[model samples]
Target: MSITNRYLNQLGPQLTERDLAIIRDVGRFKLMSGGQLERLYFADCSDTSRARNRQAVLRRLTGHRVLARVGQRRVGGAQRGSASYLYTLDVAGQHLAQSTSSRPRRPYSWYEPTVAHFLAVAELYVTLTEAARGGRFTVLDFQAEPYCWRSFGHRTLKPDAFVQLGVVHPDGRRRKGSFFIEVDRANQYGAKIETKLPQYLAYYQHHRQTWPDQSFPRVVFLAPHEQRVSYLRRLVAERPEAQRLFTVGLLDELVAVTLDR
Candidate 1:
């Protein structure tokens, strides 16, 4: 007989089909592994009240072994020092309940997506650095959290990736300075010139002064799509100094520039 049927046989007719359905759904929810299940329960029991209790009872009845500890992905916020724990379940323990798919997914707020994209770009930055014949430079997360404000303070700034270049200028000048790559895949049309450009200008001006060393600080604003290039022109027009500090171009153009290096 099927495992679910065998388990249901013991639970008896007293268990309604609906109850069985719930058990099946709760137990077999393999969409998330054991660790994820534990995190869901611990984060807010209210949301998981029914499922959590059902899972606990089902495990006991089925003689399923519940592993004590598991690791959960880091969740940050006001509870900064807090950590996530995982709960592991044995084969039988995990079997009684059917895996669930309707469970709520973890949310990625505003900055999360931006930071994630930046990390992806940073990986490419590392590859480009290695290929450029420049000393390999480490990617910096200048856009992360509170650091973004401090690093790009006085500007409306969002950076994709930052790296220290190992190559010297063609003039044979000292191999000094780092580069800041600001990626704007789809950021456009927010309050237009009155509000947006000023922010970027401020950020660049502040960023330039923040560094103590004489090393050059350059900005490469990437607009992957052709449609986005117009915004770049507006940006330069509103903030003239940006012409000196930044280069606005499409992804293909950026690729061309980098690949030539």
Candidate 2:
């Protein structure tokens, strides 16, 4: 038996299928907030029931040392009161997940500089999950940075994420929506962002040369606000090829479009 199975045997039978699923998601996403977990896992339950069940499961997992809470509580308005908790997989959780996964678990740290990037990616993931739940789209696959790296002989393209979406049509047909996401935090200059576009183009060209029958995924650049989106749009317009292979949108706009459509 694997070490994880042995640990579970010693811990008795407190864990449930739902608990294991939670651990897998935390392991995959690196970090997830309590609210995200509740929505993703217990969406079918009533609000009160979902909240109660989610908290109970989280508490149990934490108690078993399978998950650890990181990040400080957020103190703010009525919508987000001070009880928020960010959960990440602990050692036992990692072993359990890694045993089945082809890729090994990557290390994560909750330090200042990295926190914003992690949270942004998590927010995007949760938004996509919500869209899937609403029947607007089905998330065929989601690969984070570790698995999102692509090598093109002389160069490498590491997207923040790679998502394969099945968009639902009104006629009941599903269309494929593949995208490589580049998330920006409003810290980088427009020039810096523009420079990255050519790399995507090169990658697309290389992919087309290798597999002429396959369609290349669009490169979706998500920024903090509309102004940034507009700036990126102008940059995209500067290159006709980019207009075909790239898209720019505000984070809220992207989520809204996905959910509403």
Candidate 3:
């Protein structure tokens, strides 16, 4: 955690603007997939060119130890490839990033479930930004975990992210939406998720000074697929009180739910 300004200065000369952004973003998300990086940094390129350019830069960064790859994810039983990599900051990268957050935020220490869950949250962040780019709404604010976490009564409700979106209605009135997002990769048991519902209900019903706004923000559960969505919907349905505020959907449906599209 201790580094001279000269050491930090030295990193800047060896990296590009894009390189620094990548380091900081990986630090921000705690973990990221290569595809997520390409979408954020190389969207202007053709699909083929983007993959080639992304891999080229990522390879060089790994060689420099400016970035580190954790593990490969198998896709539909396919073998590991560059796209399957999940990246975190290396030693040099940690110094460059100057971050000390996440689950220790150290390289090579994360379990596979931890990596997959964080990556899904990272993907949702990307999806929101891409949606805002379409001009229907503007991204007012977005906060990832710890920052997004809310504590009420005796317990804490940790959401993946907290989001605010600004929209201009046909009547020329501006409206803003606040939401708590929970991304599910199908990693937890149904019982575990069921426990989360009550925490949110308590957070909403209580008039705690900790709650950000007067009106309660909609709580969204984004699952990996429709089947997961159906299961979650059934669970939420069991709690008649939750039906009004809680909505369940596939992760890809995030923008539609948030942006009201």
Candidate 4:
């Protein structure tokens, strides 16, 4: 039987809105951690309550075979205690949402190496969601992975994610900001990172007319550590045009500065 059929047979009509929301988020991000879900879905509660509530919900979903654990331990953050399980929509979970098609399942081993990359992307999404909730800014639009890709004639610019932000000023005026996020894990050579800059520049130059009133989305590079962040900053500084078009910082710093501006 297909995953959807199996889930229906086992769980019957027990699914809830929260359950479906979890499935939708997992399907959308391709991967998410328990902590990210808590922030996105359960932020109103105290941290202790949030942690307890999130764990309970995740356990029930996993037990029902709706969500599959992708990693043995959490990939990001410095929180104490056992790490959160990284999650992806199970076969049954995907069928609950649109735009997701069934595909052959990969062995569990395949996800281990890519968990960090997925977590990095998830972290950015979680941060933005939190910022929106705080009322500092509103997330006008967010697109991940393939959805965030854009074609410019012969070339394609695939940002890790694209976000449209509406920043609320002290006087209560909201200004629009758009950005393309690049989550660098320091896995690529410095030269490779340097090479990617020109493609962004080209995309901005070619697409200016498309968004005449709005500036080209600034490219924000979220580096894993300070050294990588510094290196990227130096490289961006060398090119005057790039200096204006790009911003680089460690994840925590970016979260504070980007949304606050």
Candidate 5:
């Protein structure tokens, strides 16, 4: 059965229950709204009769003390529109109101490599640079590549593409210190990084040993693809050191924002 139907059925004959359930299910309940009560049942009533058997049903279902009003709308015939109501569920009936505290998390979906992805990536990087501006990394030292790593060891380390940020001196000077980023999608393993990992490792080792005076730029591994994220989790489980030198992040959780916004 539909959610609304099930809610109505669960309400049973209690008018308060029905009213609360209907409002909650539809997400349309107001605390101080108004509408005419649409009486489903018909009963004999003259112009002078203030109440009828149908009205009595409401009184019996809800407590007779509850407040209500009568009204109608225009229709083709003189009977006017069917009498249905828009009513408020107030704090006085707090116990009868449904909770609206939480909702399920929105499902995350990856956007495959496309024009949108490319544009989005560029936009995101720019935003990140702006957000991190005036820090150690300078805008002039920032560089982005479409794809730039190659594997070169016995283990066939994977080659991961990067977006880099580096430090620049005030006098238009360039520094050897640079940080790299790797965005993984699908399965990191299946994404073919085995042959290219050595390059990254070599770079990591070189920077660490050679730059005793200056700090090496940090490497960030971002796993946005579900498969890649799963692989990363497993990779980290097997080897915790993966997170030491190169920080890992989930692309799925990264918020996408426009450059202007």
Candidate 6:
């Protein structure tokens, strides 16, 4: 019964399967926009009808202290409707997620800086999901953040996301590939950020056979702009694995590159 998150304890009885699925998504993605939720879950409804229904579901979760609305209404025109608002799993939400997950997941308290990176990743998630839903691509698996993280020799390689996709070729054949994604906004400086590359290279060097595929996943670095892509490519150029294991591309190219046949 904390002041900020008052208890409803009215958890299980009122929750539907759809509600649980939404919770799982928030837990996995770290954060999501109201628009993302509507697209993923409420697409069955049309226009303003879907907006109203989504607002109701979100209000119900917030009342239960299972989801918390954070920050300002998104700029341009968010609070204007409901779509631009942002959401993250609340303390109670974490407990609800744990009830259904095989492995434990704990969400961090609301903060400002990490939101952009997380939301960027969430958008990629939406793209992949929509493509799969359209029947052209198959999302074999997607693990975000902690689930995608790898620990080897006392260090963890914390890629933004990990995915295995089934790609359909022009010839009507299919192929699969795995990748470790680093969605870089260039937020860090010098050694702090450069450490991630070496960590990934080292992991690839020593742990190739540990994956079920019996080889390391190609490491893809998605940056905000062409210059950023060039910058990351420069970093990759320094490493021996540069030509063999890494790829750097603009963020928007993710779906095309990942699902490329």
Which candidate has the highest TM-score of all?
A: 2
State which candidate has the highest lDDT: 6
Q: How does residue 200 of candidate 5 score in lDDT? A: 60
lDDT of 6 by residue, 1-261 (tens): 562322434557679988998998988886898899988889879886898999889888887778888888867854445577788888788887777777656676666777887888888888788768877678898888778988888888888889999877778988788999888877742235567887887898667656655867888888888888888888888886556888888788888777652
> Per-residue lDDT of 1-261 in model 5, one digit per residue for the tens?
223534544543455444543334222212111212322122124643423433454344334212232222234533332223222322222222334313211211223333233333444344455444446444443333323333333433232334444445568665543446555654443345433344566765665676667664455556666666666556655645555555555654432211111
lDDT at 96, model 6: 73
TM-score of candidate 4 versus the correct structure, residues matched by position = 0.83
Candidate 4 lDDT, 25-121, residue by residue in tens: 6776777777788878888789678777777788888776678876456455664222367778775665555433343223223345566766677
- lDDT-superior candidate, 1 or 6: 6
- In model 3, the runs with Cα more than 4 Å from the true position are 1-7, 73-81, 99-108, 170-172, 189-191, 208-213
TM-score of each: 0.40, 0.88, 0.83, 0.83, 0.35, 0.86
Query: Which residues of candidate 6, in runs, are more than 4 Å off?
Result: 1-10, 188-193, 209-213
2 versus 3: better lDDT goes to: 3
On a 0 to 100 scale, what is the lDDT of residue 119 in model 4?
Answer: 69
Worst 10 residues of 1 by lDDT: 78-87
- Superposed model 2: Cα runs more than 4 Å off: 1-5, 79-83, 188-192, 255-261
- The better-scoring model by lDDT among 5 and 6 is 6
What's the lDDT of the predicted structure labeled candidate 4?
A: 0.74
Predictions: Cα RMSD each: 17.6, 3.3, 3.7, 3.8, 23.8, 3.2
**For candidate 1, what is the total of clashing residue pairs?**
15
lDDT of each candidate versus the true structure: 0.43, 0.76, 0.78, 0.74, 0.39, 0.79
Error of 3 at 46 (Å): 3.4
Off by over 4 Å in 1: 1-120, 126-130, 133-157, 168-174, 187-196, 204-216, 253-261
Model 2, range 136-237, lDDT digits (tens) per residue?
778888888678879999888878889888887899987887888888777852236767888898998899999999999878889988888888899899
